[model samples]
Target: MNRGRQLFGTDGIRGIAGEFPLDPASVYAFGRALGRWLKQQTDQPRVLLGMDTRESSPTLVMQVAAGLRREQARPIFAGVITTPGVAWLTRTMGFDAGVVVSASHNPYRDNGLKVFGPDGFKLPDQAEQELEGAILELRQAEPQPLTQLEPLAPQSSLTDAYLEWLYSHGPQLDGMKIVVDAGHGAASQLAPRLLTELGATVHSIGCEPDGRNINAGYGALFPERAQQEVLQTGAQLGVSFDGDGDRAIFTCSTGRIVDGDAVLWLCARWYLEEGWIANPARVVVGTVMSNFALEKALAERGIRLVRAPVGDKYVLEEMLRHGAILGGEPSGHVIFLRLATTGDGLLTLLQVLRRVAATGDDLATLVRDYRPYPQHLINVRFQNRPQLDNNPAIQSVVEQAERKLAGRGRLVVRVSGTEPVVRIMVEAESEQLAVSTCEEVANAIRSAIESG
Candidate 1:
């Protein structure tokens, strides 16, 4: 195995079903290595396993449980739970660790394994490296016999505890008309039930996971459907969750999509006003993609805006490091660190509703505090991500564009980490200018790549 490339990404090990990293044998070995690591940490350690609604989840869970049993570790099965739920349960129940079988916003044909420590945080880098090393070694060693493997009885009710906790602490949604797009994924099983139980007049879409269509153009990644539904139904608000329920996007009654930056801004303002966040130096962590208006707004309120890398995980790390209570990405993974370890889409929606109820202001009015400058983004596919900045032609064009825009706009260009494409982003005072500038920069980048 080419160890580093076999599995793992910015998040965890993920890939298509039957592929190298996600293959049953590799998954089983991962579980066994994880089990051995747990055993070394504590005698008779217990680990919690949760999975989404992906078709491959059940089989993978069984294989992982078998590996845990082989190492004499106990496995508590939490069926059809969200990724965040697994982390929350592991911390709440005092489990040695937690394992979630999910691909998180990826299609149903894909699956992944994410491990959480007892504190409900992702395993530290060093710990993950150690686990990977052990797994690589185990793969090289003699295989264990199938019949010799011990399998523990599956355990349920993990979602029950998670729901109970959510109800106990989250705001009540009574009298609110809400629409939920579960993206036919993990949240399909929990979101509708939770909303209804909380007294919201719930209208649901994308709640039916057919084992193949998760995140297929209906969730946060594709919010137009949910936005139209919100407008057509005249609902108070619309919320959409990604495949694994780790991220969320919202639509107001007027059908305007509210992203993570807007959501975080609204929540931070509410928390500050309610005295929930008492620190004078309270900061809100965001990413480079966040709108500049957000930083200005936070600064006006004496709240610091800290910028982290693109991923929600990186935002969370910055929040934890700075003792900030709120953080998120533009992709709609809002993290209220005081409430949960990871991003909880349902939790965030509830909080937004609670804010609306308390203030008696319409969603549109509340979210209008910051007017996002006109921005345009273009993605250019490339055989290889070209070093655009190192090329003098591209650099000169970028410099000329910046000088032309002066202080009235900004430009950012980079290769996407998640795909083989170069992205060009321009924010300007005028939409036309933003669009024109972005096109010009994209052309420059394309020419540079071709020449190189």
Candidate 2:
């Protein structure tokens, strides 16, 4: 078997389903490896398996569970559930681990496997590396024949339990008008029901999942659709959730986009005023891609904005390390560690809505004064990998840009983690300066790679 990755990524094992890592054989091997690890940790490990609305998800879940059963671990199926639901259930139900069988925000043709610990957090680096080694070893051993695996059904009770939990924890919306785009993923069913139960007049779109349209121009990636619906329906606000429902993007009544930064800012301030957060100045975590303007604004509020590497897991790590209650990414993954273990689109939307209701401020008024600084990002695809920081020419250009910006802005040049490209980002006081500075660094990288 080709061990290009031993099959793992920032989130988990993600790829086009039926391909190498997600293929039947490899997925089974991954299951056995995970099961074996669980057995080693405890005598009889019970695993909770959840999946989104993707067509291929059921097959993959069955195969993975079959592998787990082979190793004597019991697999509990939570069908058509969100990723955060899986995580939360794993922790609350006292399962050994949780597995999500959907790729967050990816196209319908692609799927992924994400494992969460008993504490409802993503597995740490060491555990993932160990699992990768075990999978490789199992692959090298004698091949086991694939079995006709059938998952345990009767899922209504578990689904109801989850819904009850959501309703009990959330406040009543009373007379709010909101537009929700489910992105045709896991949240298609739950988003609307939750809002309606809370007494909100919910206008739903992108809630129909026909197997192959999970993220086809819907969800957080295309907030314009939600914005249009909100305007047409005269809704007070709009919310769009990505595939798997781990992230969400919002649109205000005035057609303004309310991203993760805005959500975090609003939530942080609310938590402080409500006495939910004891330390308002402790820390607020964001990724490197977070806006510099957000950092400055939070600083003025006596809160510190700490930048982590560009991933929700990294943001969570920073949050845990610094004892921060609010952390999120610009792409709409907001982590309220006190309420939910992982990022939850439904949870985030409710939290934001709670703030709006409590403060009696319109969505537009809440974010009108907080403007993001001018920022530019360029992705330069390359044929070969090269060390960007070590290249003298690239370094010279970066240093020159730094001098020009001085204390007014910042720059970030790094290779993409999931693609064969280098990302160049620059933030400054003006759009023109940000774009020019970003291009200078990108050009240096392009020239060095082309010549070599």
Candidate 2 lDDT, 286-393, residue by residue in tens: 989899989988888778999988778889999988888889998899999988878989889878877777778888887877899888999999877788867899
Best by TM-score: 2
- Each prediction's number of clashing residue pairs: 0, 0
Model 1 lowest lDDT segment of ten = 142-151
Return the TM-score for candidate 2, rounded to 2 decimals: 0.93
Q: Top model by lDDT, which number?
A: 2
TM-score of each: 0.90, 0.93
**Candidate 1: segments with Cα more than 4 A from true spot:** 1-6, 142-154, 379-406, 414-423, 439-452
Q: Residue 420 CA error for candidate 2 (Å)?
A: 4.5
Clashing pairs in 1: none
Reference-based lDDT, residue 315, model 1: 87
